[model samples]
Target: MKKKRHLKKEAKIFLIGLGLLIFIIIVILIIPKKEKVLMPLFVGLKKEDAIEFCKLNNCKVDISYEYNIDFEKDEIIKQNKEKNSELKDNEKIEIVISKGINYQVYSDNNVNELGRIPVMMYHGIIDKKSEETSYTGGNVDKDGYQRTYEAFINDLEFYYKSGYRMIRLADYINGKIDCELGKSPIVLTFDDGLSNSIKVTGLDEKGNIIIDPHSAVGILESFKKKYPDFKVTATFFLNGGLFNQKEYNDKIIDWMIKNGYDIGNHTYSHADLTTTTEEETIKEVGRMYKLLKSKTNKFVNIVALPYGTPYKSTHANFKHVLSGTYEGESYQTDCTLRVGWESDYSPFSESFNPQFVKRIRAYDNDGNDFDITYNFKYLETRRYISDGNPNTVVVKNENVEKVTPTNLKIIGY
Candidate 1:
């Protein structure tokens, strides 16, 4: 009887062990195993090929893009994983694709390649008609320094259609022409900081000063909304009376800076540098600089000469205009602008000088010489056509010698 009982116990133990083994096999079969994959060389491959490889390996692909001068568009520039490395199925393989040569080339007929840039000078933006006002085209003054609101709007539209983009004066001096491909860069500058230039009517619910829709800045903002790519911006050269709005002066200046517009030194009291003595010039330039620095933290170190006097560098007080001290505060100027009647040279040109810049008056003269109509007609073949890359200076093969020597790559075609 003892032998039979021991045999029954052994059978029961064998059945329990067999059941446990079957359960283990079922669990192993139910759970999916992750398949390992050997990463292939994806760098330098075409983006499509890399994606195909990822699909074949049962992996996912995440693509990023960057502008590259060396790699062609859609070519793989870099990969996240190392070549021949181990990866799990469905793992992401991040890759960067090239955007093809950072610069674009336009047909020779479409682009002039490093020609002149137009730096237009403006004053007031009034809302009167030429018949009502003594000035032409509803300008505020007989000199045509102040442009009428309607004419100003028309000018902006003309510029937009003509393929001209607005750039800051500071950027122009720094040789940073950041416009679209094949488009020319133009600058708009408002002198005198008139009440109509950036009029602040009142405050909104949020306490933001309301910009008059009929004002110059207001018109610019409206035009910017109409054409998103217009890049409408201008530099407002201010005197001691910032925009002539004592109540909203601070807020207006702050808003202008916060926006894309810039503020430059128009000299305190608008003193003409030619007639002023060296000390007066220093005080004029310095006092304005100090006032602007106090008003805003980002004051542009540029001065637009009042009345465009002292046109030549030989003026005795010219150095003082460039740099001077006022009441223990020393100030310096990057460039001085003249009330010019012609467009300035390209920043990359050998003749370019930031210290002295020229401007074309924004006025109507029935297409007379030196007017916008005549100048632009002349610039049809002479305007600076961008190569779409700021880092490189593209020009005609013969004009290569005219390019200023710098770290910027020069390409002649």
Candidate 2:
């Protein structure tokens, strides 16, 4: 009887052990295994940019290490998975970052390759006294402003008359065709959509705005009439916040697109993008891109810095990228192209250097005088005559003293 009882106990123990082993195996198979995914790291991205990247990749991040970057800090150096890999949900994605470099030293020696490109800027048309007197920085005198219109017509007329073809910015960048050097290869651009851009109060008999147009449509229409074949186009960098406001301008942006012109990105609120906080900077720059993208389904990669200056700390003597919220402030050191004025277009002088860019202000009726390059010369001569010092002396009862005029210049005649 005792031996039989011991055998029963052994059998029960064996069964219990077998049941536990089966349960363990089932548990192992039931739980799902996680899959691996790819996270790409660009050469010049920061921690914030990483986060944005993660957001794009579905909230999976596992940073691995950092590298020393002499030029840009917090930039991404590497990623865990190689490019074009399928990442599973919740899988860890490791990436490497870089320690930044001194921006000031870089700016002094650094140059932007794209800076070779020339850009022309302009304010409003000098139409009213209130508008003409409003010319502050880079003053486009009323007559000189008018000459820009005349120059446009003349440029189109010349192009049409001479059979010179016009091309867009992308055409030059993509190397569509080699330009004939010293043969007047140029890019025409304007900044800020002012009210004067649409008005046509001072146009010539050729239906050209002797004064600059106050509207976008007006400018395009005028250009179309004069040089339909040359395909004259201008880039209008917009302040997204100001588009619908009563004081802000641009009723013709849509018209320009429908009529075959391109639009580029300008910061959201026209803030000095260099000094703004990372979040705000991202919001500002990103917002404009988003707005334009949503409306036009177009991607805008070009940017024009407001105030045409870099952040105080950015040390941007020329143009450089700021730390973006999406991509830390990695200045585009490789770029060389920046936009500015080529010359003072008002008075005709042989002293103009096209390399040194000049901007214009188009406002009032007087701007009509500057409708053509020759018109520019005429206005300059007139300005010289009006501003020339007259040799008139005040007679005093006491001993007379020799006096010179405050605005005197050498008399030629």
Candidate 3:
């Protein structure tokens, strides 16, 4: 009897141990596991790299950008979590990105913040004089669409002396003006992408292109050297021909973009949008955009309308010009240009509509009817003068109502 009792006790102990092992397994399966990882060093990395790391590590990321001098733009300047710190996979981390010394300040008090800005439009820049051509007196065509090389130089001098600094058309449309204090922002745009605009001659010994010194790009580079603070830049609206240099087209485009110039869509064939159906319009705009993207990744989503057709947005195919898809790829533009004759409103103004931006004809007409001279004279008291602070829009007390509601702080004096 004693021997039987001993065996029962041993079996009871074995069953209890098995039940405990099963209970432990069940508990482990039911309870959630706490997963953790050490935060990697994120500071000094590019913002994109840090975000990508977070995306793979199952961590949440918050980012903010600020003007930083020490760090390059888009580089991570700071991080909330330290390197090697234990963090739950779901924890959030905040990072600050550098905007690369984009801040400026000035104490001038005479800025006219609620005024118009000039978007100057130019075409072919020929190395000819009036005596060489049977056109008007100035170095321009009779219609003034083309300006002589000498006349173009004179125009640059006029703009610099008149306190106008060059800004990209894209920046102006986006309201990101970055000129000096008391200076007005001026946008330079060249249409047609003519040979004279950027003529690439034979390559040099170093295989670098030899741009004709009198070409539009050559003159602008020389002027930029003379007036470094002018921030001399222009947007060249190009068709598929691309400055008409079939062999050196890609090289010229790459050079322009690397040198801080902008390229925009002028349609694949310079198709007049008003004459085309909706599908045709999309193809024209989209094909040019796609072609540019294929050449360089830095495609500016702005189009200079061919002949400035469909001048209003009410046209049936106008929306297609703004955004559309062609052959499976989609394209969108932020603003459209007209063969305009006057200055456009300040982007901060309630009257500003990026859908249709006007431009001034950069030609000589004896100061007549919306030409360069006439427009500058008209803008003397009505120019959008910089307040030296891009984060705020300061205007006269009477113009407060004209300020557009924005995230930017609005102040009226």
Residue 267 in model 3: lDDT: 93
Q: lDDT by residue for model 2 over 293-402, one digit each (tens)?
A: 65564333555566654523335422223323333322221111233332232111223222222432332233343233333333332211111012211112121222
- Candidate order by lDDT, decreasing, is 3, 1, 2
Q: Indicate which candidate wins on lDDT.
A: 3
lDDT of 1 by residue, 32-149 (tens): 9866788887777898898788778888999899977667788889988998899886898899999975434545435554599999998988876556676666466767888888
**What TM-score would each prediction reach against the true structure?**
0.80, 0.41, 0.74
Q: What is the lDDT of candidate 2?
A: 0.44
TM match of model 2 to true structure: 0.41
Name model 2 segments beyond 4 Å from true: 1-118, 126-165, 177-183, 195-216, 242-252, 311-339, 343-413
Model 3 alpha-carbon drift over 4 Å, by segment: 1-109, 137-139
TM-score of 3: 0.74
Question: Each candidate: what lDDT?
Answer: 0.86, 0.44, 0.87
| Residue-by-residue lDDT tens digits, candidate 3, 196-299 | 98898889998888899889999999999999999989999999888899988888999899888999999999998889988899999999998999999986
As a whole number from 0 to 100, the lDDT of residue 214 in candidate 1 is 82
- How far residue 40's Cα lies from its native spot in candidate 3, in Å, is 29
